[model samples]
Target: MAPVFAHGQLRLYLLSLLNEGPRHGYEIMRDLEQRFNGLYTPSAGTVYPRLAKLEEEGLVSRSDDGRKATYTITAAGRDEVARRQLDLGDLQSDLDRSASQLAEEVRSRVKGEAADLRAELKAAAREARRVARPAGEPMSGRAGSEFERQINELRSSARKLVRSRRTSEAVRAEALRIVREAQQRIDDLS
Candidate 1:
């Protein structure tokens, strides 16, 4: 997928951020991530080098404050940002659209999954009711008990994963593996 910021766009955007006020490298990174709604975060390697280049060009000045380097945009940086104010506005609009689109996609998928699960549960309940049963006897037995338990567990795990704001790649891969395994198990039963 294409990156959110185009070439040279990041440089200009960083200049615009620094134009806000002095900020340390990590602070700048977090600010950028926040602006993208956690969908995009530039790594330290990507950001520090750009800051260094800006410093070299005298577009920004850096001061060491006890193990932390804070960068302040120079007059030239402010001028550049001012010159491209419209471009900065456009960048903000693009980022807002990207974030909104991502959020909407996630919501739609979650709703679809919930609907599917509800349908499956209803079908299972109907099938259980159709099976022969003694009067006044509640649904209980080894028959389909294991399957129900597994489905419940899977549902709980999925809910937990979805509720989390962030998850590592390993966790996400594990979730996918679990889902695939559950589907395979269901297919095997059929």
Candidate 2:
């Protein structure tokens, strides 16, 4: 995956953020997410380490209050920000580009998933019709009820997984592959 920030850009951006005012770690993360228009959100693992590095370099100072540590920019940090005023614009432009790319990737992935889902559903519907009982037969029985229940459960699970934030691209891709394979197997059974 392409990174949102170039090599040392995240450190510089963190300094710039601190220059704005003292902020807790979570606040900084939220700021970054908002800056990227919800396309990118840095995890705590990413943010805390950078904060530690900045603190180590004397660019920022941290004060612990209860369970939370707030970071404030030092004078040196402000000087660094002043010196990199030109680079700041470049960073913002890079962030904008990254967000656009991320959005496009997301759109493409969703489109592919929709196409796969539609294809699978159509195939299943066609198969179901082919195997369906005669028109005179009432569609109410243990088998019909069980089939309906299973289909509804499958729909609910798919919706929940797709909507979850924890679902990675690999997971989604694997899921689609599994569905396709299942469809193939069902077709074979016919």
Candidate 3:
């Protein structure tokens, strides 16, 4: 994947964020994460050092309220932001492109994984049917049909979830967990 921010771009971007309003370190991180649609989450190690650099440069001022420090942009910071308005716009465009690429990659991977799971489940179902049948007897009718229906429903649901742009990371993670557990149980059945 390409770097989300080019060299020195994040520093400027952080200043722009501060120019909007005063914020604590974690809030800045959260805001960045939200901006990227949960694609890029900056660690404290990444953000705090840059913040410290900005403070050292007198581009921002920090107020320590015992536990947490809130940072606000200085006059110089606003001047810098004003001076680099075009650059900031360009950076935002780059960020949007990067985020879109990342989202597409995630969607592709999820779709591929869902397809793999479907194939595995189908194979497992076949194995179970074969194992459950005697030499001359067919698979159990109603029970087998019901199991097939459940598998179809699972596949359909997984496909829909994977394809939905509105699906959140948390929801995607939980769905993956449930699918993996179901695959494990089905494997055990065979």
Candidate 4:
């Protein structure tokens, strides 16, 4: 499950990733895709501004490597990450519950088909990216179409998963698959 947030969860996730070492923007995003399986990955469009904000706040330090714009954590950022790590579990649980609740709603109302909590969680991530799509960028072509299609398929899968799910193992299996798929997408994009 992802961390619960109406927004800016990606910022926290990025800060947490950067706490490990200096990395370029692409690396930070790819790490998230790896961690979440493919169900979640932050985009450069989303991550870069958050990095800038952390820099402004003295949490992250910035160094331009020609064009790479490498980012590293400052003491304050590390402290922030430490504090947040304590609550990371809670955040993920809350997100899982939210997706479960969404699935329940779908099951009760729409042909008794539940949403897969796992897939719904991925849908949430895709929604975040959709919101982050830049102005004047057409949602067309290979990349955009692939993203949109994945979002739709995940939603469909989630609904089915939630409706028929009866075992913890099944849930875990589906979730693991979603995570792997999302991570693969990030790798391909990178």
Error of 3 at 143 (Å): 17
Tens digits of per-residue lDDT, candidate 3, 1-190, equal 6678888889989999999999999999999999998888899999999999999999999999899999999999999999999999999998899899888877777676656655665665565555453445565677667656766776787768767886656557756776687667655754
Regions of candidate 4 where Cα sits further than 4 Å from its true position: 1-5, 92-190
> TM-score per candidate, in order?
0.62, 0.75, 0.72, 0.46
Model 2 lDDT tens row, 1-190: 5789999999999999999999999999999999887778999999999999999999999999899999999999999999999999999899889989888887777667656665655655555544456556777886577657656755676677667886656547756665676568656654
lDDT tens digits by residue: candidate 4, 1-190: 3332457566676777787789998888787666544445566777788889999999988898997888999999888888888566666666567556655543354332223454466665665455445656677676677777766776676656545644334465656566677667545543
C-alpha RMSD by candidate, in order: 8.0, 7.1, 8.0, 18.4
- On a 0 to 100 scale, what is the lDDT of residue 35 in model 1? 86
Q: Tell me which residue pairs clash in candidate 3.
A: none
Clashing pairs in 1: none
**Model 1 per-residue lDDT tens digits across residues 1-190:** 3467767878988999899899999999999889867767889999999999999999999999999999999999899899998999898787777778766665566556555555554554444444435556665776447546655765775667656765444445555655565466445544
Which 10 residues in a row give candidate 4 its minimum summed lDDT? Answer: 106-115
**lDDT of the candidates, in the order given:** 0.74, 0.81, 0.81, 0.67
Winner of 1 and 4 under TM-score? 1
User: Is candidate 3 or 4 superior in lDDT?
Assistant: 3
Q: In model 3, what is the error at residue 117, expressed in angstroms?
A: 1.6
**Candidate 2 — worst ten consecutive residues by lDDT sum?**
123-132
Query: What is candidate 4's CA lDDT for residue 29?
Result: 77
Number of backbone-clashing residue pairs for each candidate, in the order shown: 0, 0, 0, 10
